[model samples]
Structure formats: structure tokens, C-alpha cells
Target: MTQTPTPATPVHWKVVIDTADPHAQADFWAAALRYVVEDNSALIGNLLGAGAVPAELVVESHGRRAWRDLVAVRHPDDPYDEASGTGRGRRLLFQRVPEPKTVKNRLHLDLHPGEGRREEELARLEDLGARVLRRVEEPSGGWIVMTDPEGNEFCLH
Candidate 1:
């Protein structure tokens, strides 16, 4: 007799992006996807008051205190920490880097726009500083390949 194997427990995952400017990328992506940028102001404030974080490492974002070297955005519909203002689902974390991107991304995001709104969404993203890299087609499917202002590749399917 043949038997199916038991499914493994799902593990949590987060997408990490390398960038010279994390804040800018976070802003662009947040607007493009209608996601809310995570507000760690309370945490930052506490750290600052305790002297755990240097004052120079903080910045004013959305009229609140935040870390200067990192930021994250998440789906607006997802559950978030009220005190810290961080999303619990579909989050994108941006961290600063000293060097610029010089190679193709081995991993990228594929956006399924759904139905006939691909062009419209693409246009809107372009207006938000995304550049069209190319249009690709295959026997099985097709999509518009684009890059963010910082040149990180993503697609509109």
C-alpha cells in the first residue's frame, strides 16, 4: 500500500533587500503596493531615552522617530503591533548598504495584478518611479519585468 507523507510545519519567512538607501526603497515600495511602512517610533523612542541607541542613528519619519539605517513596510490589512506599529504579515524589510547593486537578482517578486489591469498598474508604478526593464513572454505565460528606482527587479503578471 502507498501512503502520503505528513506535511511539515510551515516556517516564518521574510524578504531581505540589500540597498544603498533603505528608506527611499521602503517608501517607493510602500506606495506602489499600498502597504503601510512599519513605525518603530515607540521602540526607538524608548531606546533613545535609555541611551541604548545613539541620537545620530535616529531620524524623523512620517513625523515619528525611527531608525536611520533600516525600515520595513507591510500589507495594510495585516495584523500589526499597535505599540510598535509593525506588521505581522507580508512585510518587506530594507537595510542600508555601502555598495550599489551591480548584478541581476537571483530572487525577485512576481506581482499578479489579476485580470486586465496589468497595464494600468504598470503605468501607476511607473509614475511612482519604477522603470520598465522589459516585456517577457513564454508559451505558458507572459509578464512585464520592471525595476524599482534602485534597480531591484519585480514583475507585473
Candidate 2:
């Protein structure tokens, strides 16, 4: 008899980004990706009521309570924990950093908006405060590099 190996469990993860303004980054990313910003007001309220969280550590975002140093955005259709408003799938967490971004990103997001809709999507992103850095044309295909409001680099292909 031969034994079949069991598949490994998938790891859960969220991309952590350093930003000078986490709330603004969260808003920009949420709009750019058509995702929803996670709201943790209920959890914060519970913690505050229990004296488990400091009031100064929280801030009002979208008129709701959120962590002052961090914010996240998640795919609208992804499963989330109702108690904490945290996503179980694709998500991005932006954390506050004291210093500004002064160099190119070592890793960046690459967006695919479909075959021929790249230009349309690019225009929409520009309207959302993204500026085109440059356009790249290669033998394989082409893409447009862009910088977000705070200057983080990303590409549209």
C-alpha cells in the first residue's frame, strides 16, 4: 500500500506598508484597488470600555474609531472577522512611520486591469491622486509606472 501525502495548509498574510500617514494611505489604496477599508470601531469600543486600550492610541477615521498608528484595506468580497473587522484574505496594512520614503521600493504592487482597459484604469488611478512616472515598452508587452500621493511606486500592466 502506498501512502499519499497530505497537502500543506495555506499561510495567511497581509502586506505591511510603511507610510507617513497610514489613514491617508489606507484611503488611497482602498479607492485605487476598489477595496474597502477595515473598520475596527466595535473592537476599539469594547477595548476602551474595558480600559484595555488607551483613548489616545485611537483616532477617528471615516467618522469611526481606528488605530492611530495603523490602518488596513481589504477586498470587499473577502471573509472578515466581524469582531475585529480584519480580513481573512488579500489585504494591505499601512503603518505609521516617522520618516518619509526617500528611495525606490524594493517590492511593489503590479496591477492588471484586463487586456485593453489599462489606459482607462490608469486614468482613473490618476484621478485618485496617482501620477504616471514613466511608460515602459518591451518586447513582451508594456506597462505604466506610477507613484501614489506619497510617492510609493506601483505599476499598471
Q: Model 2 scores what on Cα lDDT? A: 0.96
Model 1: weakest 10-residue lDDT segment is 9-18
Instruction: State the C-alpha lDDT per candidate.
Output: 0.90, 0.96
What residue runs in model 1 are displaced by over 4 Å at the alpha carbon?
1-9
Clashes of 2: 0
The number of clashing residue pairs in model 1 is 0
Give the per-residue lDDT of model 2 (tens digit) for 80-104. 9999999999999999999999999
Which residue pairs clash in candidate 1?
Answer: none
- The lDDT leader among the candidates is 2
lDDT score, residue 30, model 2? 98
RMSD of each: 3.4, 1.6
> For each candidate, what TM-score against the reference?
0.91, 0.95
Steric overlap count per candidate: 0, 0
In candidate 2, the residue pairs with backbone N, CA or C atoms under 3 Å apart (3 or more residues apart, or in different chains) clash, namely none
